[model samples]
Target chain A: MTVGIVGYGAFVPRRRIKLEEIAKVWGADAPAYKRGLQLFEKSVPGADEDTVTMSVEAARNALARSGGVDPADIGALYIGSESHPYAVKPSGTIVAEAIGAVPALHVADLEFACKAGTESLFIAQALVKAGEVKYAVGIGADTSQGAPGDALEYSAAAGAAAFIFGADEDLILAEIVDTYSWTTDTPDFWRREYMHYPRHGSRFTGEPAYFRHSMNSARGMMDKAGLEPGDFAYAIFHQPNGKFPMRVGKKLGFTNEQLETGWLSPWLGNTYSGASPIGLTAVLDIASPGDLILLTSFGSGAGSDSFVIRVTGRISEVQDLAPKTREQLDENKIYLEYGAYAKLRGKIRMAE
Target chain B: MFSPARAWREYPQRYRLEAAKCTECSKILYPPRLVCPACGGRTFTPEILPREGKVVTFTVIRVPPAGFTEQTPLPLALVELANGVRLMVQIGDVENPETLEIGMPVRLEFRRISWDGEAGVIFYGHKAVRAGS
Candidate 1:
């Protein structure tokens, strides 16, 4: 059974806060941060936008391109996010109900920091391959939080990407060639139960966590598939920043041309769980038939999920069915200043 | 704050935009009324209202009730859908309330309507964003 993406879609909030805008508030050097992280602006969720809401919209877009797959027939759905709106409640139930996938659906909310979205994708495709469900939806979304005046604030952003998996050859746009996951208990970044924002180990978040896991995952996946980095038409690594994906791709023998299509962290910021998944959506927007795409996503608790996808002829037909990821990233963007951004992100304290 | 029962009862309308169309008169009723007022029809079929529409009329609410203070000057509009169904909904992603005009085209998007608090139920519904945006 060939389980792959039957439909795919992505959603990014219209509002953006530029790095300079955030830097001006804290009196930090904008040029330095920009040059260092290779990030300029990040998507800001509206007052009404959250992990669950974004997931719903992304899922709706996925269903739109699903070739009329009845929402009721979706047997399972999973949403992966670090910033699920509720601590105890499941975001999947709300998403399932909204998309008309209820009663006969198996749904769960997954969290593993940034790679959570890929986690959803991994599980969703596996179930389809196992003949457990005819179709399954995997979504990665987040309105991530960063502490005030922290470096993470500049890149912690909002966005979502959703993929519907099925074994139906007629519907599969990108057939899954192989999948691999590399995980270890590395506490590079974390937030306590009651903490409002996450904490990182500065440079430690690099070498040992992101780069190590991502590199290992990509290498292991290529080795297992007996395919080199040069064999892939496009390669997407977890883009915590614009610099990391490019650097890691080069380290793994992938050219900039192969990595550029999915390198979205520069302008879109790091959407945690949505980071690489959204990048994959961007690549799928313009991918050619038989294009081989390698997607590797990394999370801070330390894990990476890599997928080898072979695009089908159906890619072109469905590419125009929904909004493209690049268009959403570049066009009709509503930029916000520091004050408005603060208010919308709930950084400002309200009167009781 | 909306009770769980009240919110759950309206899920059909809020979440899916489910409406009832009169079998006899072909009139659409949002909130899916049991009886069609136009023809006094007792039977109706389930229908989904179109997501795209034009603003028939709108108002900017400066002093909103609780649960809406964050979105001060909230722009609410009565939009007439392409299928001729009219409904009132909040205008989302509007940076300036002054930009809202009569007949401005819009598309409804799922959004968080309201919530009880940090730990309470978060209500989800559709809000109108400028079409093509």
Candidate 2:
């Protein structure tokens, strides 16, 4: 039973808002945001884009990279997002139906803040490993919200990543070596039941929230897999900002070259649940056979899900079957000003 | 709030573009019905519409509908697919709506149609994007 990723895909909205555009509005210096946060711009979802729509697109791409897997064969579908468009309905149902993975499927929407995406992946992988399903799709996506003028405004962004897992050895592009999770009761960030925006506990989101959970989960997974930081060809962490992932990687003895390819926060900003999943997609786009990749995701409620994956020869056969992650992130970008950004995001009130 | 039944009923056309093709006359019916309008044929084969198409005509909506005010000057177009199936869809990813012309090649992209309200059901459907963009 060699259950692992068969195909994967990513979706990044073309619209971008420079840190300077956001900084100028709140009277904060643009240079400070760029230098301190290590962020230049963030992707913005268009008026037509949301967690659900982005998830559908990413899932379609994943199916394309799947080397002709029938959508009808997907036994389970899950989507994780902090910014699901509908507060009540299931995003998984819409995504599954749109991608033609309906009728016979188990579907649900999961939320654990940023780690929500990988959490779905964790579940889907387990289901395949347990032989409960032949194939499962997991997606992490968000049109994440930040208060009008908070530090989060600089990083909260939109994107999605989808991964399909199966046990067929012939189609496996990577093999799941092992997985581990570290969780605890930490209130580093919260949003009221009906609040439009989330509030963070400032410095608390750092050491006690993201760092504590992420580091432990990564180390735990490594120890369980009997591997070390130096053994992996690529290591990616949940990027709340450009700084945290690099810092955590360094503290864990991972090198800059190991994290560089997946370091997209500087350009794409923190896509919440899509953060680590999208980073893993970037790494997969370039990784070769025999490559070992470690992925760790952190959520504000404070938990991390870490996985050790070993790339297989099938990677090269399907790597170019769909659009590459870098191609989506780099091409056809449309820069937006603060006013358009505000309007696009529905931060402006207009008569109904 | 829109009824889930309303959304559910349209799932076939909205999700997979499932249509009815007349087995005898070869006429394709979008939103497949019990009887074909062209040839009065009752028997039909299930067909999925081609995703690539060309804009037939278009309009720029400066004053939008209730939920569309955020994207004012929205470009909506009637697109004709390769198989001669035509449908009205919102044109996206264009920097300027006024520059749009008939016969502009387009590819179908699934996106959110509109929000019912602040906390309402989000309608998802197909929109048109400039091919290769």
Candidate 3:
């Protein structure tokens, strides 16, 4: 029973705010921020877009590429997001119902900072392998937030990616070769209850949090799968910023070419849980049969989840089934000025 | 602000664009009427309408009602689905109202239609975006 991704899709909001737009409002140096983060622009969800809506779109695309899998046949669904619309209400129920997988499917919302998305993917695939469900949908989505003038504001963006896992060999687009996770109670980033935005440890988030966990998880995955950096065609690390993914991938003995395909943070900013998962979708768009891909996602608590996937012959058949991730990122963009971006993000306070 | 009950009752149409096709006359009724308007048919089968369509007519609402002020100048359209069923929907992802024109190809997408408030249920429904987007 080979359990793997039967279908995959991604959704990125069309609205974007460039670093200069945000910097002009804050009276900061846009060039400095761009040079440091290597991020020029980031996505902004509309007034109506959120984790749930984006999840539904991405899941629908996944189903489209799934070769006619009925929505009702999905036995379980999980949505992982740090910014669930409601704290008490489960995001999974709404997503499940919207995708037409209600009543019979087990659903839950998982949270582990940025890695929440991959966490859903990991559990979804495991359930299929255990024969607990014929198929499961795992989604990572976020309309992530940063304080108005905080450094995170420039990069905390909105996006989502969904993957359907099943044991059906004929439907598998990418077989999951191996997986590994590394976790520790490092408070590199956090937001308390009722807090509107998150706080990070700045420099501390680098070496100790993102790099340590991502490096360990990638190495552990390689060790478990008996493969090396050279064995994979592409490697995607948790992209907190444009610089981190490339820097970390190189540190792990992977070449620039191996990491380039999935390094979307330069143009997309950091979408938190949607970061590496969205990157994976972009890589899958151009990946060839038998191509080996490595993915490592780091969340700020902090932890990292890594997977080694081997693309199957069905990859080409489904590559154009839905809107490709890069096409969403590059085309039909609606660039926003700082004021409009603020209104959409609800940064402007209203009279009660 | 819509109550949860009101929102819940319309989930089938709002979330999935579900309709009913009369077994006798083949008339498709959105909101799934209890009885077919044509031929007096009570028995019908569930049908999911095709998501792609063309805008038959449209208008830009410059002064939006409450709960819709954020999307001022909202473009509402009468869309003729691929099945020839015409339904009214809010056009989404429209950066400029002037870009809208009749007979433009469009596709339905899931989006947040509105919400009650900070503590109320958020409504989700389908809205039309430019086709191929």
Candidate 4:
């Protein structure tokens, strides 16, 4: 039973943030956000959508498009969320029930910061390869909230994606042929339980957390898989910003084209959990079975995961919102003031 | 607009306006490049940029990113330092952006560009101030 993506779905919230709103408040030109940061607009989550809700939405669509899920046939359900609604309860249980994955399915949450979603995919592939039950769902979802005036707020956005791995003939959209990983005891980024948001050393996140871990993992995976850098048609990684990916590509010799395929996050801010896997779904929508897709992920606590996937040519299309591409995300505007940003992000709470 | 990554790459250069002056030629590299463009020299010598310079050009930004939103209506100037190094930076303490001149004197400043979410991890980057008359 080869494990791969049988179905895939993506969900970016309906609301969009205008580039000028941020500029007007900062008393600066919009060009900075647009040209400097390379961010046009990012998706804003609605009141009805949280991590679990978005995850369910994407997973449900993925299941529906996959020709209906047996619910009981799934052996495991893993939720990869950095912005989980609850700190303790497993988001997996909530998502499994809402998506009807039912009991007997292995339920767990993966939280390696931004790498959780990509890591969850590997786990699902392993379980399926071992002939566990049959189908497994991996979901990466985030409604990332950044502090006001901080670098994270403007770019941080909301989105989610789900990928299913099963043993059947409709089988994986791409098989995880090889994998590699790297770890360093560095704190490039971390969010304490007491803190509502994550803290990252700006330069540190780029050089050490992102560049080092991702490069090491990708090279390790490439070397292990016996594939050259140019061999992979497309590659995707956990996107924290528009610049980091570009810088990393310069090091790995990935051309502007290969990097463009995974650039949704920077223009949209780091979607925390959804940053990477959602990108892969977008890639699958356009990729063919023979296309080689290399992937890498870097987490805050300093961890990286890399995988090589070969498209199956029969990539199933999953449902999505009104926007065909994230490029149109700019048109769905609901530009907010700082006060509004605070409220939407739940920074100020009313008495219950 | 300046993220930490951009800040670090320009750290010392940002402080004293230190930049690489290609040893092969007197050509001034404002941001200090490892590889010299003028003479195709691989190694450049690091030197402090001249403090007094004229604004070669400038633009006013009504919109800014996370760290710059508060400084909206900000003027950014491309100044040619005393040493003839041209650098683009935020020009603060200017009362009127329209009154801005192409050869305005700009001084260096250490400022907070933005922070990460949740009120911590301040990202420091360099900005410019109009030199006192």
Candidate 2 deviant stretches above 4 angstroms? B1-4, B82-84, B98-103
Error of 1 at B77 (Å): 0.4
How do the residues A1-352 of candidate 2 rate in per-residue lDDT, one tens digit apiece?
7889999999998899999999999999888878888999999999989998889889988988887889999999999998877778788988988888888999989999899999999999999999998899999999998999899999999999999999988999999989999999999998888888998899999999999999999999998999989999999999989999999999999999999999999999999999999999999999999999999999988899999999999999888887788888888798998999998887998765
Task: Please compute DockQ, using alpha carbons, for every candidate against the native two-chain complex.
Answer: 0.82, 0.68, 0.78, 0.01
TM-score of chain A of each: 0.99, 0.99, 0.99, 0.92
lDDT of each: 0.93, 0.90, 0.92, 0.71
Candidate 1: list runs displaced more than 4 Å: none
Q: Estimate, for each residue in A222-300, the C-alpha lDDT of model 3 and write its tens digit.
A: 9999998999999998888898999999888999899999989988988888999999999999999999999999999
Candidate 2, pairs of clashing residues: none
lDDT of 4 by residue, A1-352 (tens): 4667777777666566665676676676777766767776677764335787677667755765565657668888887878876667677876676455666789998888888887788788788888876888888888878766677767788888888888776645677777788988888778887787777898777776788888999889888889987887888877777777777866898888887776786556678778878787777766766889988877878888888988875653432321233433433344555555555566676433
Q: Give the poorly placed runs of model 3, Cα more than 4 Å off.
A: none
lDDT of 2 by residue, B1-133 (tens): 3576898788888877888899979898887888888888899998989888999999898888778776677899999998999888899866567658888899888887777777566777888887655
lDDT of 1 by residue, A1-352 (tens): 7878989999999999999999988999999999999999999999999998889888888888888899988999999999999889899999998888997999999999999999999999999999999999999999998998999999999999999999889999999999999999999999999889999999999999999999999999999999998899999989888799999999999998999999999999999999999999999999999999999999998999999999998998898898899999999799899899999999999876
Error of 3 at A99 (Å): 1.4
Ranked candidates, highest TM-score first? 1, 3, 2, 4
Which window of ten consecutive residues has the lowest lDDT sum in model 4 chain A?
Answer: A316-325
RMSD (Å) per prediction: 0.9, 1.7, 1.0, 23.3
C-alpha positional error of residue A26 in candidate 4 after TM-score superposition, expressed in Å: 4.3
lDDT of 3 at A97: 87
CAPRI-wise, candidate 2 is medium
